[model samples]
Target: NVDKAWDPIRIACHVYIALHAEKNEIVVEAETDDDCTTALGRIRVTLFHAEANERTCRARYIVEPPPASYMRKEVIGVEVESAEIAKDRLDRRVKLAGPWLTQKEKEDWEQKRKELMASNEKVFADHLGSAFINLCALNSSMRMRVQFGNIILKRYRTEMAKPGFAFDKFVNMMGQSRTGADFEKMVGGIELGFKLIHKIHQSPDMFCPLDNMTGKLSDIKPKQKLIYRKCGNVSFRLEADIDITVRGGEYQLGENSLYKEDSALKKRLDVEFLAFNSKFDWALEIMTQERLSSNSIAIQATAQDLLSSATVEQDVMDFPYPTLGPKRRLNGKDTANIHTIFQYKLMGTPYVVQILLARGICSDVVGYCGASMYSTNWDDHMGPNEGEICERWKLGSDLRVLFPLPPSTKQSSFATGGQVVDKHEGFRAFLAAVDKVQTFLSEAVSEK
Candidate 1:
């Protein structure tokens, strides 16, 4: 098909690699006409390997023209060069998050990485809080926490939207027995479940992730990786599950209002971290208790349960029995007689998100409100593989500011704060009137 003047110097080459086999082919064509449609010589190249598959090994080949008088088909020569292994090749894939640490921080992290790799047992960080001191800076931690929180919310919303959706399925996966029917009654009713409720500053901008998230997270931010080692970057994952059950025993809305003394609350939290590069894993369980004084009261827990002393506590500084630490937000005056209950379980969700970055991978009871910790090994309670840290923590304005209160109630300061509407307000008013009259009659008799 030659259409142009012969040009032996010009050669075109293409290579094709077979997916299912180790064989690769390289084609060489020499143009011989001006039409660019004719080739005077064609040579086919085939590669053969002694022990390598298509998945690994690098290859190089060479081709030469045959003598003019001795040609018996085109001569193609192949040479085997040293092949590079897969692990040694340059890796050019997307990384989650890294290259954010300073030089000194990277060096420090490397030393720690070496230590962790050398140890057979896991390194435990009991009260894993968002302490800006950890390798993951405070700003980075917050960004990632908000991102992960949004993911959980999105997944929840998607699943709930489907037909025959049940919240109990998620709870059960987290190892709980409560069903969807039970969850609806705890927060008043299905309509009231997950209502907008805020605490602390109650500013919508500062607290809620749902409204603030611009888009999905491409990669979990504030991720860490050891500079000296080949192990992959250390990333974070977050999950939130909730269950609302009646206190002491299950009760209907109107049937047991008078007989019930309080609504006992509980938080069953499980935190775990697995370090593949370090070859270790750490995990722990947390159980918390609280109570709402009565129905119709928006905010209802004790000060110890509402503030920092509930989840993050200082054993030496706070009262001994409560064993609480400093408050994340709010003062004594702010929490005084404030109702801690809300239409939705908004308050607890943020804490679950923040605590993931609190410390290293450890199983301890440090960042939970009125919580107790349990472990398989009793000796490891206080340290790695051990016992509980046992400190109380209060929810702060930063976590509460996301939820804005409805316009109907503006007289209150905190979103959760409001006037109580007792179910038997009229009866209680009548009883007060009768008590005043009886007191006046007794005073008159004494005077006579």
Candidate 2:
């Protein structure tokens, strides 16, 4: 839970600062692989006293909450013992399935689980040990001071109110098995654990922070070559507000009132790029600039091979689903090789990701945004036969990224009420929530 909350708080503050005390707008082009469908969306962000908001956000987080303060020590000890018992049961179950295991795939899950457990056990044990010693070494007054500090930490109540905060901590401390390999190996198990928690807790935003934190943790750093390397064939447009005709792919479009650094529309477009880059691991390059009749700017470039040269199996799972029509709903996770076409800057800009599927592999053309099974919409020409012939295969989940959500400028509002939206609505919810918070705070302060 601490780890999950950590990212949003950090990001919310980071974005609040990044807006630079200005109203910014973003136009997003969310598309599926097929190139047949796209969602055109726009977001407007208004920052009120951004400088003061940033400070308020920072100041609100000044004090720390004691880990698991609500649970009594005895309760914690019981939970620790229960986790060990569950681990034993899980070990036995995995062993029972050994008859089905192949020689190459023969691996013990217990080892990974142990590592995760040890990390948590060590933390809890340290706290217990301190308490044991403190009983004799520290007086009542000292304990009172500690307890009082936790109570006075003004942000603790709001932080704890975040959806699924308690359950998140519980899973981290007890449900998760530590594994060294990245989330690729851990996602299935992790998702199952989170689902179980959600079923019991029933929070609308139960898994929101967990999902965001997982993505943040899973994000790989941009490589040196990946950052500026030239890409292959792709096309885009350069547009502006003025009435100048731009030849296709032949001219630079930064010389007029339309391309001014401080233009409202230009600022909005720049923030969109910032949000897009923040979400995906693509190494973007402005290949060529072209002017379309619609008075806008675009640069098109193919998704260069930014991934490491490691074998496909090492990078993404090879699990396949059967080929289906564009309207079919995906029942399970499907893995495929994906090709990204163009990253554009428009509310309705068409972004395409091609899914190359193997025999028995199918693509999910549509579904809810937060659900794991949705696909980057499919290309009409994709075939099951081609998947077997293709040498490259990668996970679709890696390519179907969530929309960008930079934190709003209002500190207390986002800090207090941001978890109401799930993955799909997150971007817009962030703007709306913070706007509401800003309004409330302004009125409250004015009344004083």
What lDDT is reached at residue 275 by model 1? 16
Alpha-carbon runs more than 4 Å astray in model 1:
1-209, 215-290, 295-352, 355-448
What does candidate 1 score on TM?
0.14
Q: What are the per-residue Cα lDDT tens digits for candidate 2 across 180-291?
A: 1000111112233223223312322311222232332112121111111112232222221111122341222132211112211111000000010011111111011111
Write candidate 1's Cα lDDT for 268-317 as tens digits.
22333221111111223332222122432222222213322222222221
Q: Give the Å error, residue 423, model 2.
A: 23
Candidate 1 lDDT for residue 98? 16
Question: TM-score of every model?
Answer: 0.14, 0.16
TM-score (C-alpha) between model 2 and the true structure = 0.16
